[model samples]
Target: MIKSKKLMYQIIAVISLGLAIFGVITPGFPATEFVLLCAWSSAKGSPKIHHFLHANRFTGPVLNDWRNGKVISLNNKIFSSISMLLCVCFLFYSGLNIYFIGFGLFGISISFIWVWSRPSHV
Candidate 1:
């Protein structure tokens, strides 16, 4: 059971990592969240995979900063906030149901607030 569970986790980690990598080149997809999810699943499934991600040149520092300090860089904060705002704007203008628009706005507002509340990594 343990082995099977580990395998499942490894699979999830790989899939999330792939999506995160794809997000790097695809606009409107957030890579950081996927990368964090990958890290978490890898840690549960395979220490080797976790170490690789944690030691990777591009991802290592980000993971370390988030893990150690719960810090988000100013640039990231700005980008996230802008993205959320844009999404809210698009939803509002897309002729969606009023309830859906309201929910989207509420969620985006909450996310924006949370992102700004984090310590800036500088």
Candidate 2:
């Protein structure tokens, strides 16, 4: 039963990631939610995948750091920060004024900071 649940979670994570990836080219699409969902689901679903993510050469450091409860990688942290910055830029550029998006960006930024700041052994 546990294995089945894990498998289902893995499937959900993969599907969510796929959708997030596809959203990349779709206008007005938000992929971050799906990516986050994938991360969360995988973290709870399978230790193997979690370990793989933790040890991944490109993303492992961040994953492991997250698992250990440490700060996110400088690269991911910078990337996230820049993304939020771009959201602000886009908001200003469009002049349409969707201020709520800023809140989401801010929230995500805070989440990253919180996770990264956790002890490096979580």
Candidate 3:
């Protein structure tokens, strides 16, 4: 059963890995999401791509920490903080805002909290 699950993860990882790369040149694609998904899959399945990701000095610690069941880190928190600030500033300046924009903000805050709330051994 575990093996089957790992295989599923591997397939998904490959697809996400492809999408991540493709997103680099695609206007409507979000490269980060796919890359994160690929990282998740590789971490869970022990794939070669996981090793590649882990070998990166920047991304390795975070991915490895996630694989080890740690939730968040200072780096992610700072990134999220900066993102939130930028998004809020953009919303204020662009005037393309709507009532539901708060919901989006709320969601971002929630994700930040959820990911960073737990302590990691890494």
User: What does the lDDT come to for candidate 3?
Assistant: 0.69
lDDT by candidate, in order shown: 0.82, 0.61, 0.69
Q: What is candidate 3's lDDT per residue for 11-119, written digit by digit as tens?
A: 9888997996776555323444576798988889866988887797756776666667755577656665666666666666666657657766676667666655777
Per-residue lDDT tens digits of candidate 2, residues 1-122? 98898889998878876776664545334454555566678888866655654565644555455546444556555555565566556655775646676765576567566545644333
Residue pairs with clashing backbones, model 3: none
Off by over 4 Å in 3: 1-11, 14-36, 43-46, 69-71, 120-122
Q: Looking at candidate 1, what is the lDDT of residue 52?
A: 93
Cα RMSD (Å) per model?
A: 2.4, 5.0, 5.0
In what order do the candidates fall by lDDT, top score first? 1, 3, 2
User: Which candidate tops TM-score?
Assistant: 1
Q: Kindly indicate the candidate among 1 and 3 with the higher lDDT.
A: 1
TM-score computed on alpha carbons, candidate 3: 0.61
Q: lDDT at 19 for candidate 3?
A: 94
Model 1: per-residue Cα lDDT over 42-108, one tens digit each: 9999898899999899889878879988887787777776667667768877999999888877776
Question: What TM-score fits each model?
Answer: 0.79, 0.55, 0.61
